[model samples]
Target: NLPFSFIFFNGASRLYRSEDFGKTFTDVSKVLKNYYIRKEFGINVGPENSKKVILTADVSKLKAGGAIFRSSDSGETFEFINLPFHPSQGMTFHPSNPSQLLAYLTGVLCCLDDVNARGNLHLQRTTDLGKSNTKLHTNIYSFGFAGQFLFCSVIHNQSLPRSILVSVDQGDTWNEAQLPPVSHEQFYSILGADNEMIFMHVDEPGNTGFGTIYTSDDRGILFSKSLERHLFVDSSGANDFTNVTSLRGVYITNVLDINNTIRSVITFDSGGEWRALKRPSNSQCDKTAKNPEQCSLHIHSTYSISQKVDVPVPPLTAPNAVGVVIAHGSVGDVISTLLPNVYVSDDGGYTWWKALNGPHYYTMLDSGGLIVALESHPDRAVQVIKYSTDEGQCWHSYNFTNETFMFVGLVSEPGAKSMNVSLWGYKQENLYKTTWLSYTIDFNELLTRDCDERDYVLWLAHSTDFGSRTDGCILGCKERYQRLAKSSVCRNGRDYELSKEQAFCQCTLADYMCDFGYYRVGNDEKCVEQSDLKDKVLEFCLKGKEEQSGSWSRCGVERIVEGQTRPQGLGLD
Candidate 1:
C-alpha cells in the first residue's frame, strides 16, 4: 500500500514518486520529457488494480499551451490525449467511478458528448475518461456537485448580481441560490463543494468598514449571515480558495468592496447557521472582575460659560468597537490579537479565551506547544515568523536563510501533525511545499540541521519569539504613553525584552486606549484620546501639583488652572 505521489513545476514541470508517504522520493522526470510549464496534475490509485494509473498533464511546452499525457503501464510509456489548448485549473476522477473523468479549463469543463458551455461559466463531464469532449458551462468562476444537482457562482464581474446559482439535471438550466443581501462585488471569488453548504465573504463599501460572511444550506437556496468587523488586506481581500476541504454541499467565498478588505472567513455549521471562523470585536475587559467598568472613569463634561454657566453638553455618538482578527482554518472560530494577550474562540464567534500573550502573525504547531506570533522585526530580516506553546504564554524562533512572507497557514490537513508557516517564491520557481514543524520534538531536530541550504523553511519555530502579556485597556491623561508602551514599543522593548505575557497585555491596552484628542467620556471604557489643549491641561495639572508639592490650594488657581488648562478664565476655563 503506497501513499500518494508528488509532482511540481520549478524551472520546468518535474515528476517524482514517493514510496514512503512523501518522506523520500526518486525523480521520474526522464519519463516526462519537455514538461515545460505545468498547470495542474491529478492522480487516482486504481481501485481494482493499484497499478493501473491515469495521468493528465498540461505541458506548457508551447506559448499557446501544452499536452495532456496519459499513462496506463506504470509510467513505462505515455500517450498524448490531444485536447484543446488552455490553462487547466483542476482535474479529477468521479469518486464513485474510476472510468469517469472531469477536467476544468480556463472557461470550460469538457466531456465526451455532453458539452454544456456558456459565455461565462463552463461545465463539462466525460462518460469515457478523456476520450472525447463536451462543454457543460462557462458562466461561473468554479462549481462542484450538489447531490443530483450542481452549484456555482459567476466569475469576476462587478456589474453581475453577486449570487450563487444552482443547476439540476446537468447544465441545462439555472436558478439563483438563496443568499443574504450583499453587494454584487463580493461575488467575484465564489466556490462550492458537494456537501450542501456554501460560504461567501462580502466586503462592504465605505471608509474602513467591515465585511460580512454569508452561508447557505440546501444547495445555496437559503442563507445565514455573520458580521466581521476587521479588515484583512491580503490578495486584494479576495476569499482564498485554499482552505475548504469538503466538496458537494460545501463551498466557500469571501467578500470585500472594490477597495479590497479581507473581512471574514466564515463556514456553515451542520445546523445551517452561518458561523464566523474569525471575528474582531471591542471586548477588552477583565472577565473575572465583578464590575469591569469600575476600572476606568469616563466623565463627559462641557462647561460653557457665555454668561450661561448652566448650559448642558450635547449628545454623543455611540462608541465604536475595536480589535482585528483573522481565522486560521476553513471555518474555525474567530481569534483576536487584541487582549488577554491573545484570544481564541472555538464556538463559532460566540465566546473567547485569553489564549496567548502577544499579537501573533503565525500561530501553528511546534515541538512544545501551540505557536502564537507577532509581526516581523526590522533588524532580523530573515526571521519573521514565531511560535508559542501554552496558548502564547511563550515562544521559540528560527531564522530562514531567505525571507518567507511572515504569516501562519494551516498545514493543508487536520490532526495537528505539522502546519505551513509561510509561502515563498524564487526567481526560477515557487516553493509551496516547504513547511514548518508542529511538534516541539520535531522542531528541536529541525534546528540541528544546516538549516540554510533550502531557499526557505516554512515551519512554526524558524521565526523569532514574541514575548507579550497584558490585556489592552487604559483610561487616563497618559493613555497614549500607556498605549505606546503596551504596543510593540513596550512588548518588544529592551526593558523586559517583550515577554510574551507583557506583549499580550500591552496589545490589549493599546487596542482600547485613546488617540489623544477625544476621550471615552462614558461609564464604559469606550473612549478616545484627549485633545491637545485637554492633554496640556491634564499635563500641567498633574505637573503643577507635583511641582508645588502641596494641595490644590497651595498649587493656586493661577499656576495650576490658568496656564495649564486649554481655556483661560476663572476656575475651570
Candidate 2:
C-alpha cells in the first residue's frame, strides 16, 4: 500500500519527505544561503551512497539569493557543495561519479563539485567534479550529457526560441543542429526525451496554430523532416489555451517514438495520420475562444522532459461531446462543446461514438482511475463531485463540505515528494487541496465575503438572494424553470396555468403582466392576477352604482333619518 515509500509535509515549515526509495538524503543549503533570499528549485534525491542518500536543492531567491543545497541524511539536515559563478536554473548528478555534478546558471554555465566552477554553453569540464570548470560557449539555454556527445539548446535571445546545439568535445565549441524549413523561430522549448532522443515543441512567430517538429538523428545536428503540426504554445500561449494537458505536451497526436534514427514524423504527414495515433486524446491548442467542452488530443510521455502544447482535435468530425451546459472557469475542453452523440475515431479526424454527456463545472482524472465531475449547484449547500473510472460509463458522487462553490478546476505544482493538486473555485476565490481524504480547506479564513462590483459572484448567485448576502446563495434570481419545478402546483400557489413569460413576470416582475380584468400582481410589477369584483362593488355601494337600466340606484332609499321627502338621488348617494 505504501509503494515502498513514505511521505510527509509539515505545512507550517513547508518541509516535505518521502522514504522507501532511498536510505538517506543529503542537504547543501549552507553553501547556498549566502547568495539569495530563497530558492526557486528544490531538493532532488539520488541513489544510495555509503548508507547515505544524496539530495540536491536550488535555494529560494529570498533565502540566500539563488544558491543550491545538497543533503545526505534524509533531509534532517543539508550542506553546501559549491557555488558556481552565477545562479543555477537546473542541476544534475553525474552518472559515474558521486561528487561530479552539472549545474546550469542563468547567463553562465558550469560543471563543478566542491572546488571550482566554469563553462559558458557547450561543455564545462570538472577534473574534480565541482572542483574545477571552464567556459565553453555563450549561447546555450540548457544542456545534457548523453553518450559521447554533450547536447544543449541554445538561444540567441531569451525571447527567441533556442536551436539544438551539440559538442563532441567536452566544454569546447559547439555546432547548431541543422534541420530544414523550421528555424530557430519555430523552436521554443526542448527536452531530452531519453538518453538518445531530443524532443522540441515548436512555436510559431505570433502564436497562431500548431507549430512543427524537428528530430535529431545523430545528436543535435542533422535534424530531418519538418514535422508540421507538432508545435505547442509556451506559457504565454498556454494562458490563452486553458487546457493544462496541452501546455504540458501530453496530447495523443504528438508522438515522440524512436526507430533507430527517429523517422516517421506523424503530425507532418497529415491530420489523418495524427488521428491514427489516438489513444486517449491529449489536450491541444484551442482555436475558438469560448468552447471548452470540446475534447482535444492529450499526449503522455515517459521521460521527465517538459510537456508540449495542447493537441488539436482532428478535422471533419462531429462536434465535441463536452455537453451543452457550461459553468464558467470549469476545466476539461475549455473550448467548444463537441456534439453530445458522437464516438472517437483513430485514423485522423474520421471517427465516431455516442458517449456520455459532459458536465460544465470541475472535471478531474482522479488517481483512483475515475474522472470526477463537479457541478455548480450552490443551493445544494455543497458542490457535487462525480467520479467515473471507466471514462464516462459510470460515476460515483462526493460532496465537498464546508465550501460554497459553483465551478471548480484542479491543477498542480511540482513538489519535493509528489505533485500537489489545487482545487480552485470559479466564484469562491479561495483555493483548496486534498492530498489526503480528510482534507481541511481553510477557505473561510482566506476568503472575503465583501461583495465587489467587479467580482464574478455579482452575477452567479441566485436572484432572490441577490442584493442580500447569505452563505451558499449565489447572486441572481433562480432560473424560471427551477423555481416552477419546485412548486407543489403547476403555477406554484396559484391555480392558473403558467407560461414562460408569466413565470418570468411572477419571479422578476416584468412590466407587461397587466391586463384588462387583471391587476399587476407582484411587488416588482410584472405579473397579473384576477381582482375581486365583490370587494370593488362593496366599496362603491355608498356612492350609488348606476343601474343597468339607467335608473339611479339609491342607498337605503334616501336614508330615513331626516324623515323629510328629499330627492332620491340626493340621499347619501
Candidate 2 residue lDDT tens string, 449-499? 422222211111123243453311111112221111111111111122212
Q: TM-scores, in order shown?
A: 0.42, 0.41
Tens-place lDDT digits, model 1, residues 303-377: 111212221221111101001122221112221111223444322223334433422334343211234354423
Q: Judged by lDDT against the true structure, how good is candidate 2? A: 0.32
Task: For candidate 1, report its TM-score.
Answer: 0.42
Among all windows of 10 consecutive residues in model 2, the one with the lowest summed lDDT is: 317-326
- Model 1: weakest 10-residue lDDT segment is 314-323
RMSD per model, one decimal: 23.1, 33.2
